[model samples]
Target chain A: MESVSFPPLSRVAICGGTHGNEMTGVYMVREMQKQKMDKTGSLSVSIILSNPRAVEACRRYIETDLNRCFTSDLLSSPVTDSTPYELKRAQELNAQVGPKGSEEAVDLLIDIHNTTSNMGLCFIFYSIDWVTLHILKYIQSKMTSVDIRAIQLDLPISEAYSLESVGKHGFAIEVGPQPNGVLRADIYNMVKEAVDHIFSWLQEFNSGSTFEGGEVEVYTLVKSVDYPRDAVTGEITAAIHCQLQDNDFKLLQRGDPIFLSFSGETVKYDDEELYPFFVNECAYYEKKIAFHLGRKIKLTFPSINLTG
Target chain B: MESVSFPPLSRVAICGGTHGNEMTGVYMVREMQKQKMDKTGSLSVSIILSNPRAVEACRRYIETDLNRCFTSDLLSSPVTDSTPYELKRAQELNAQVGPKGSEEAVDLLIDIHNTTSNMGLCFIFYSIDWVTLHILKYIQSKMTSVDIRAIQLDLPISEAYSLESVGKHGFAIEVGPQPNGVLRADIYNMVKEAVDHIFSWLQEFNSGSTFEGGEVEVYTLVKSVDYPRDAVTGEITAAIHCQLQDNDFKLLQRGDPIFLSFSGETVKYDDEELYPFFVNECAYYEKKIAFHLGRKIKLTFPSINLTG
Candidate 1:
């Protein structure tokens, strides 16, 4: 692979509270704003608390999910009196830090999130951009205290829906095992450390330093598995089995127990073996995702230096 | 102490969805209803979903906390169009299973709940009624797979503000470490087994068996600790410290680290040693409770037989 050259990264935005109940990002962005962290070395940073109404209500969103409101189609959609609050907020956020697919968008957007799943610390991004990949590599190297992994959402730029998709180079730094509406010191610290490392990597990158790249493992999303439901009532009939609970990122065998029905019957996985992530996430209960299956593959990147 | 005599427990009610996001109880009550389990030996069982609106929305409650809406004052208050949905539901529930202080109330009410805390299989009740205490002992003896404990609220029967207080002899079976809006197979099973044991105990007592005198460990309500907050903003500045997180029912010594601030400072407990439970419950975050402090004690109950 040829070394890719890109313009020097400058404007960066750090967003939080996209999902109101996720306290880690909510507090992190607040703490950063409190400290007036506008400039970190060469990069100018903007601290944003997304979806204020949702954050005020301590809900995932007041209307539709704000994280899913950022696709090019939705962002450009005309607003009206009856428009969902999240969709309106999405346009406002895009206007502030991005005009999607434009050169004026922020150089990098690091949106922080916390999941109820025991995913440790993960980077979720759309497409495989070298800049985001190198940052993930840098953070993984620096933050040796916990496991660092990435989930690549295979989607076109125009179709990318998350808040992070608004930036030139963006990814969500998701750290968890923390429940919604509750915060844990360990989980909070892990996020803080990851954010600090991100800033450090930006400084090193902007300082005209050549970066050596190597193979980094990434989990490409395969498909989501919904909980077994009663055909008549549409209520879930079983729960994630004890064997699979909190076992995110573990490869699922064809015969492994995935769900335990209320009638004391075990429902085994009968699909091709794949790693599971977001296993038993709290918010996904409404979305019908018991967990998401992914294929793990290693990607190699080339060394790159910033263009003048 | 002499053995106490009580009327035969003929009518029993099992309530779920009190805090609608607590899925263990929601599913248990639904399952019991699906099986049409209305009769068990000498007892007539009623499966009730206490907060249907909240359950349908999958929220803790629509207007207010339903679990706190069951006091005599709230139950007997005149209904108005503006009254909170939970208060109205509480009154309706009282009419069906309780008229609470009246003789027509159900004999026993087993309200099931799930907490985000690590408290495993706990019984929470008001007053230290002999009937409820004996039932706790029965459950503890039968369910040896998990630690079974009890929390005494120390409130008058008239002042008790919970669905369980609606019955003549009732207590909430709280099992967890399970997050709200999530159902865990282990937690669901624990709640199911505990409910089954309650029925078995009831059947044996109804058959003229005397419960043996024994001492059971209880955590009496002491006080609640809020997360350290910023005075100006009233937002929490700290989270439950790593040392104290998930260590529910563990004795907290004076000077123990109870909170870790966002700036990396540890806030130590400055009060008397106490046992902590409901540590980091998700729903209580809005109620401003980081965790609850309690005093551990052993209550000894005398043998009691049902009077014909």
Candidate 2:
């Protein structure tokens, strides 16, 4: 990809509790709100505690997933008709940092999330934009120990409304292995680091420096693999095969055992070797996704001069 | 304590999903149900899928904890009067396996549970009884790798009514470090072994065998310890200290750090040394319990002739 000049970001927003049980983001936002760390240098920063009620209840969401409610069509719908809890929340949130083309919109949005899967420092983006690549490169540069991977959701989900879609440059940073609603120091610190780095990068950008040359391994979503379920009962009949359990980011060869039934039956993957993430995500059980398969690709961008 | 003769067992009940997210019991029961293994020789076994709704939702309970709803006062209340979901379910359960004094009541109940804390193979009893002790001894002997500890709820909870309380002889077996709703093959096997052992022992007892001459360590609950909280907001400010996060069933000395705050402040335990279990339990967050401190003591019972 050719190096592109970054757009000036005057206003930035950090959103948390998009999925309430993902407490790493909620606590990080709470800590920042409590400390009144609203801005870095001249940039105006906004902290959003999205889905506060769900966060209080320690659930993913009260109604539909707030993340999926970010589609343009839904955003254009009248607020009076938004009866679902998350729909109303989406409207309120969009009014704050959204309506991407509007004058009041924030220049950038950072939606924080956590997962039950062992996906470490996942940078998720709706579009393969320069801003997304820059942030991924910056975060990957600093956190060498963390398994850094960029995931571009090329599925129909591109039209799926997410908190970030409302801003000019919007993306999500997901960190975990932590169970829902439980906070660990390691994850909390990682979250803080990612947020802190974003703010620091923003400050540098506002001072006329832009992230230029870098390369990152990008994993594009292939398809979601559901757990083996009983044909009649629809009940999950097997678990993620022992060999593949917790093996996020690992390459699995064709014919690899993906699930093991209670009766010792094995379900194997029969396609080409693929890199998988979100393996055995506890939260995804409701969605019936055991894991998501991804195809790996490399993205290299040349150095560019960006001024804010 | 004098060893007493084992009581004859004609009926046995294994209860699961008493706390829905504890899937070790739920899956074991499901597996057994699927296999149609309702009898261990002469004993007529019944598998109770307690709190079906909560199990379906992958939550601990829809309302209050079902385990805590077994009190006679609550059980005696009408279904309409029992406003909570669990209260109504408890009444229904009491009708089936309870009203303990009735002839139709189950003679023995084995309620299984799993914890987020690192407690391994915990045998919990409300009252001291030979049946509880012997079961503990037998399981401990068979699974030496498991940290077998007996916990007697010496608090007002002794009358808090649990599923096991309905039977003449009943106790709860808790295994953990397993997250709620997620089942591990190891924990699943452990639960099956415990149930298997109980059924075999019952079969042996019915065939005129008696248990005698055994000693086991008992950890009597002293009190629950809460995590460090903000004095003004009452919100938890710190988490279980790093040293004690998963150190369930381990001795904790006074002056040792029990919690580590976000600000890097350490809150130390100031009381006498005690054994702590259920450390950082995800479900107990609602109850504000970081862990339960216990007094460990050894109990020995002499041999006596048991009759059916």
Candidate 3:
């Protein structure tokens, strides 16, 4: 593969509280704002609390999920009188820092999130953007305090839906085992450290340091599995099995216990062996996802460095 | 103490979904309703889903918390157009099984609950009632699978503010470490086993068996501690310390770390030593409680038998 070069990266945004009940991001943004962190080394940083209303109410969102309102079609749609609060906010955000896929977009964006699942620290992105991958590698190398991994959503950039997609290059940092609306000191510390590493990496990159490319393992989502439900009532009839509850990112084999029915029966996974993640997430219960299955693959990229 | 005797206990009520998002109770009540569990030997059991609307929405409550609406003052308050949904529901419930402090109340009531704290299986009640204490002793003896303990709120029966206080002799079963809006099979199983044991104990007592109650250990409420908050914004400034996160029911001494501030400062406990429970509960964050401190005590009671 040929070596790649990019223009100097300077402008960046750090977003939190996109899903307002996720306290890690909410607090992270608040702390950054309190410190008035606008410029760090060679990069100009913008700290944002994405959904103030939801944060005040301690809910995921007031109308629709703001995280899902960032696709090109939604972003470009005309605003109306009855438009949801999140959609209106998304438009304002796009106008301020996004106008996504345009020349004036921020060089990079980092949206921090928390989950109820025990998925240590994960970087989730759309497409195979080299800058985002290099940042993930740098953070993974520097942060030895927690397990670090990357998840590729396999969507076209125009179709990507999330706050991070508003930037020229971006990804979401999802750290967890923390419940929604509650903060854990250990989890909060991990997020802080990861964000610090990202800034350090960006500083070096802007100063013209090359990032060596290597075989990086990434998980691409295969499918989502929903909890077993009663046909008549549409109510869940089973829960994630004890063996799989906190075992996010573990390789799941066929015939492994995945769910335990209310009637005391174990429902086994019957598909090919794959890794499972977001296991038993509290917020996903409304989205109908009990857990997601992913296929892991090794990706090799060329060395890259800042150009002018 | 004299061996207390009462009319053969026959009518009972098992209440669940009072707080709505507590899945253990919601599912227990749903399963019972599905099985049409009305009679268990000589005892007539009424299994009720206490807050149906909240259960449907998967929220703690639709308006004000239903669990706190069962006090005498609130129950007797006349309903108006602006009455909160939960308050009205409380009155309906009091009419069905309570008319509290009246002769028509059920003989025994068990209100099932779940918390995000790692306090294991606990029995919480108001006042010192021999029957409730004996029931706790029976449950502690039978359910060896999980840690079993009891907490006394030290409030007069009429001043008690929960659904269980509506019964002639009542208490609540609180199980946890489960997040709100999420269910665990292990937690569900423990709740099932406890409920089964309660019914078995009731059957044996009604069959003229005398319960041998000697010494039972209980935790009595001392006070509650709130999270460190910002003076102006009222937002929490620190999180429960890593050492104390899930260490509910552990003894804490003065100078022990209880909170870790956002800027990496440790806030030490400066009060008397006590056993802490409800540590880092998700729901109580709004209630301004980081955890509740209690003093452990030993209560000695005489064995009692049912009277004709």
Candidate 4:
């Protein structure tokens, strides 16, 4: 209700549980606070336990991936027709945090996450700028286990992405490979370490100007993914990201062949299957191949552009 | 016709005529290119010449300042009623360069600009984050004359702005009081210094993570001096650094009185003599002062409520 309540002298934000399946970071922040890792000066930690509904229901976001829906365009939709409640929570929390988009003033964000691949005990991705350089050095001194990459996030490079789309210079530390108990503890320890790292460095590091964040290297815009649906039984697959990218007929083309039924019994294409219709030879570009030829780069899918 | 094109290995962007009067940066880029300032492989400078029509017609963009028109809501209708050409040009350039909102590859953009500061010598705005840290340090170590800041941008920090709207991360280097060859030379020197700094560093730095560029120290935003039509005429006589706190009004509230125009006959907020108003109150905010309030904290405009 208060428009501008006095900001705590120092604030720390640990946001997680966007996807019910990824609640490790959520509980970790809570447990970290529960364990009393915050002892430094006036440092207050705020945790946004997003998606209470999904967390209660034990689902990843019922309708959508919470991470992909934070853009300005998608966030502008007033109606919550098919929008998952988690995103609405993000929007509301965003409103509470500060102004949307450019006016947001997030000092430091430690978005805790867990990746599918069990690589890099934890990876700290950031733009390789000078502020980040000192941050990297300072953080590396604190965290010897985390893998940090200072990538140039521009052309001929991967697009850049912020941790939670909060639009500040933040990084997501992936805990482990799954939504298991052990992974949660790994995430908890990392967060505790991160908080300490921030506290120590921030207390002494005052030489630089304010921290301005970086551009995205590669865009992780996994807009939409198709799930397998049973026709007669009407049962949806319990898992995602597994069968989504396999030889599933969901990504059929205008003229490409489509095999129906898990046993490969039915055969169809543009005229037969009821999903992923390609209008032209350049229609289907969802996850199509984008490569280079002699002198030009070409993008091709079932029906989206045969030539560059 | 291409959505995004980077055929040139290096790019140099020049945005001029933002004020319709300051066209020095525009001509300097063109001249520098004629002299072959654009280098490939190590550095690619993309030139974004702004307000081509304003440059030719010789008038500041009226109705709406092109620089202030980069808001998300206004992207569709960048300019209103008048300044059709300016709007159209903006659209074309954005189309070519593509929106910064896209998670696609981007190139180095050095916007050339000229200012009418009856104050100090020329300065170059160094973007913050990873890349900018190097740029700033190198600029300081290499180019000693230019002043720099690492202000959080008013526009979306992630969304790169056109010259007209290169937010707080970017700087508006004021050359010698305009209308003099010295102003033109200052613009050239600044651009050349930036280009040179980037080139020298690229040899050693090669590339860095986009998000991890550098940190900034002193940051500031451009607070426009809004006025009524008939209230004030030429010659901005207000002393600089007078400090106007935009606390009372909403972020973009129009007709907010900012300055008092004095012309002997009548001192007015605008030439039209409309109702006097100023965003002096920022009523919604509990804390309204601009200076540091004791604790080691930074002011992220529009206070974020830690607790709901």
Best by DockQ: 1
Off by over 4 Å in 2: A80-82, A101-104, A155-158, A210-212, B78-82, B101-104, B155-158, B210-212, B303-305
Best by lDDT: 3
lDDT of 4: 0.40
**Model 4 chain B: ten consecutive residues of lowest lDDT:** B276-285
Ranking by DockQ: 1, 3, 2, 4
**Model 3, TM vs. native:** 0.98
lDDT per residue as tens, model 2, B235-262: 7887777788778878999888888776
Off by over 4 Å in 4: A1-308, B1-14, B17-19, B62-64, B77-83, B118-128, B149-151, B157-176, B179-183, B207-216, B222-308
Greater-lDDT candidate between 1 and 3: 3
Greater TM-score among 1 and 2 belongs to: 1
lDDT, candidate 1, B60-135, per-residue tens: 9999998898899999899999999889889889999989989999999889898889999899999888989998
Per-model clash counts, in order, read 0, 6, 0, 70
DockQ each candidate and list the results. Answer: 0.80, 0.41, 0.79, 0.01
In the order shown, the chain A TM-scores of the predictions are 0.99, 0.94, 0.99, 0.55
Q: TM-score for each prediction?
A: 0.98, 0.92, 0.98, 0.33
